[model samples]
Target: MTKGLKPTRLIADSSPVMKVPTAPAHLSRDAKTEWRRVAPILVERCILTIGDLGILESYCSAIGLVREASKHLQTEGLVLENGKRNPAAGIMTTAQTVALRAASELGLTPVARSRSGMSAQADPDDDTDNPLAVR
Candidate 1:
């Protein structure tokens, strides 16, 4: 699907009969945690597969880097000697941008919601009384 296009149809009722991919062993603790948290949701939604593991790992790593950099920024402040902004702030910003970009590509960001034409109040059960419901 195109990056900014809304899907006009719902997913098939049949789930993909594929095994779930395991998280890479090289990921950091926090990255692994993130992988464990999001991988199943993507699999169940049929939006991801074993081939996409590398990209997902990269996204999770970027998230971990952002979190670590933010902690350093909180402790060390944003400026350094000679009134220069701390380099860690730049690292944090760059990491956050990369993470957001990865998430957007994976359709996990707020922009994806807009692109998919999703609304907070949308109801899946509203089809019950409609004649067009496929059963």
Candidate 2:
């Protein structure tokens, strides 16, 4: 038995499916939990459920949160027809536009990749005002 070494009997060398660690959790504990807590709220504000709102983008390869939102809007009949007047189209607010733009920029079309790479989740446990914290 060595001071810093695991006992040989306790070590089982085996290869399992890779596990991804969370982003470097250097943030203060309070801030870290607060960020995790706020993420769902932000997604709701963006008119998406937390699971569909890019939170699971890291795990899923299907259409991301933005595309889903667009689909939701379309299903709700908020789409403006070509050369047609729709009084309800005006109800599509500016926030929805921004979300759609972001989704488009992220390549949210059906052909989009479900998994791009292992990018770190934007941990907002530090400064909430940071642009990088934008979902």
Candidate 3:
């Protein structure tokens, strides 16, 4: 992931980790994969409480949509028979916007981490005084 220790790195703190719930059944398979991938990162960072699951789901779903739309655009080409832009391209752009916003909310983006007080040059494995660290 990142080069420095994230302020959300929970293992650096003595507090117990609170794992988020498993991927929701309503999520698509790709969304589930995303859920699994980020859930652990959030857990380790101690950034996700149970209440944040909805945002997480939204992020994953948007990412899934982006993936599906990208695939559609790839297979069908970026133009329709009438030469109009493919709708899937629009879908992908919208989903990507949604995912990026949701990821920022989840502190999954570099800017978000920086906003949470994680300096880009901070040392890895040195979580002392980390603003987001579990107490």
Question: In candidate 3, what are the lDDT values of residues 45-131, reduced to their tens digit?
Answer: 766766677889999999999989988988999999999999999899999999999998788998887663443334566666666
For all candidates in order, the CA lDDT equals 0.69, 0.37, 0.80
Comparison by lDDT, 1 against 2, better one: 1
Native-referenced Cα lDDT, model 3: 0.80
**Mind giving the per-residue lDDT tens digits that candidate 1 earns over 1-135?**
668854533343343425567778888777888878877866665656555667788888988888787888888888866789989888878878888887875667766755532332345556644668898
Instruction: Give the TM-score (vs. native) of candidate 1.
Output: 0.67
Error of 3 at 100 (Å): 0.6
Top TM-score hit:
3
**2 versus 3: better TM-score goes to:** 3
Candidate 2: tens digits of C-alpha lDDT, residues 80-113: 4564544344333443455345444333433332
Q: Between candidates 1 and 3, name the one with more favorable lDDT.
A: 3
Regions of candidate 3 where Cα sits further than 4 Å from its true position: 1-17, 116-135
Which has the greatest lDDT?
3
lDDT of 3 at 49: 64
Ranking by lDDT: 3, 1, 2
